[model samples]
Target chain A: MTTPAMMYVHDWRAWQPGRRDTSQPRLSVAEKPAGGHVPAMLRRRLTGIGRALCDMLAELDVDADCPLLYASRHGDGERTLEMLDSLAEEAPLSPARFGLSVHNAIPGVYSIGRGNRRTQQAIAASGDEFAALLVEARGYLAQGEPAVIVAFAEQAIPARFTAHFTTPVDTAAVALRVSLTPAQDAWALTPRPLTSDDTAESRPQPSDLIDWLCGIRDELHCHRPRQAWSLVRAE
Target chain B: MTSELEQELKHLIIDTLELEDVTPEDIDPDEPLFVEGLGLDSIDALELGLALQKRYGIKLEADSDETRHHFRNLRTLAALVEERRTA
Candidate 1:
């Protein structure tokens, strides 16, 4: 089976330098905090996970009324940590933090901020975040109209939850606009079984996958069918 | 502070605000009660207003400026409740 579709990929770091690369005729969104030499508006909006989603959606050229799909590997870790810390200290949890702690709060906040009624937030802790997100996005594509997907993953883990995994990296967010319109620039999705002796315990890390995707300057093939999908990075 | 009013307000705040780790006695009266005070926001204010209106038959006027002034603190909210109760 083949899924032929047009997709635009954006990297938060590349868009930091404030030079517009109009190679793909698409808008770009990045997560750059203050003092990062990036544009002030971009820096201001992409503050936290929920804010990042909202900012990214705001930057897209898609019709404001179109549906959105937001996927995250780990959603709202800072808020989770804060809640856990409050519980440990026996202090009252901030109601705002409590509301932002939910995994779907990113999408909910974006919906509220944009006044859009159609949005879905998907959180997949499993190794195949991109694959799961693709499946979800495909459902939107099935509607025969354009849909936007904003997928982000950050690296800051709370010390209280350190025992859960092993990885140290910074944050990254990517927003892609996908439509049913067939275009010359598109990536093909193909699934294949694993022949290597790679067990579930030895899966590729999120940072590693992100790095590989970001480094692609030309046509590249991603082999991990269950966990991998290719993006034609907008130049 | 009337015991019944205090108790009812505490329960309503706890339930409406979803203060999972707090009980009625934990909320000290006369304490500053927004953000750094109680960490509540405009959304919580609307929610609490709705719950209070539904439960006590009191209506918070839709004027944003008026609602902000009325929801300044628990004391103000309590005073409004007292007024509505008497009226």
Candidate 2:
């Protein structure tokens, strides 16, 4: 049996930034606030990933000062595609879009908004993003952080790139509350090799792992093209 | 400090930029428009150029250093528009 890590799962929350208002044109500016911690002024300036991140963070009610790990397969989905379109057309890219299209823009904005100067990491690892997120959280806990908020958000793959990429139809965010509390259920992580060639078990986004942690399965295995992680839930 | 042309330019900046929570009166005519003043970035400059063309029938040269000077502030923008306005 792999030694169970001391990290405890406190609370988890998920949010869909703009599932409603389907009337809005796709791949354009996002809709108004569907409810989140972000102020109105900031909301107007947020990309889809940023909006989803702030929304789930508000729901989780974690301290702004807690170390944060933001993971995403595609950091700023729509904005990135838009930038590409501008490049093809030989038009000047929007400075605002170019500035916020970076992988860490969401968390960078969050830290600036709350004035939290703690170390915040932004991660992007193709299929093993969830495993990477948890692993980073564990590292923070080992470094003496009382708690860690692992937030993940991603937008749908742009239509032009759908032929080459795999992504969900909507934008979603999930916040996992990983703490050092000894009372709650815990999970053990171990590196394992794939005995089978089944790649279907791998999840594309971080929110999918929430179901496994929510007791949907006692043991879940995550596989990436290069790595595999075994997560065992405690009874 | 609040001339009629400056007030119009301020209104144009606010409307074109979609700057939320900011009013025309909040913009100082002499303050820098891009960096330390209204915090508008390069993208805003493009959008503002287009909006100015549509409203004042004036064309901003993409490669002209004078265009950058005219976009420095509301006062400078108004003067450029006043010098170029045909109607």
Q: What lDDT tens digits, residue by residue, belong to model 1 across residues B11-73?
A: 888877766556677776667556656666565766677677767778877557766666776
Which CAPRI tier for candidate 2? Answer: acceptable
Compared with the true structure, model 2 gives a TM-score of: 0.71
lDDT of 2 by residue, B8-69 (tens): 88888787677766998778888899878877867678778867777887889865899999
TM-score of 1: 0.56
Per-residue error at B21 for model 1, in Å? 31
Estimated TM-score for each candidate: 0.56, 0.71
Assess each prediction's global lDDT (C-alpha) against the native: 0.56, 0.70
Residue-wise C-alpha lDDT for candidate 2, range A151-170, written one tens digit per residue:
87666787888988754545
Considering only N, C-alpha and C atoms within 3 Å, which residue pairs clash in candidate 1?
Answer: none
What tens digits encode model 1's per-residue C-alpha lDDT throughout A1-235? 6543334332222121232342432322334322232233222223444454455566663346766665566666767777788799986565555656666765665665566676666666555556566666677777664655546455466666768867653455555565555446543344445557544543333444344445434323233335366888899
Best by DockQ: 2
Clashes of each: 0, 0
After superposition, the stretches of candidate 1 with alpha carbons farther than 4 Å from their true spots are: A1-46, A189-193, A197-214, A217-235, B1-41, B44-87
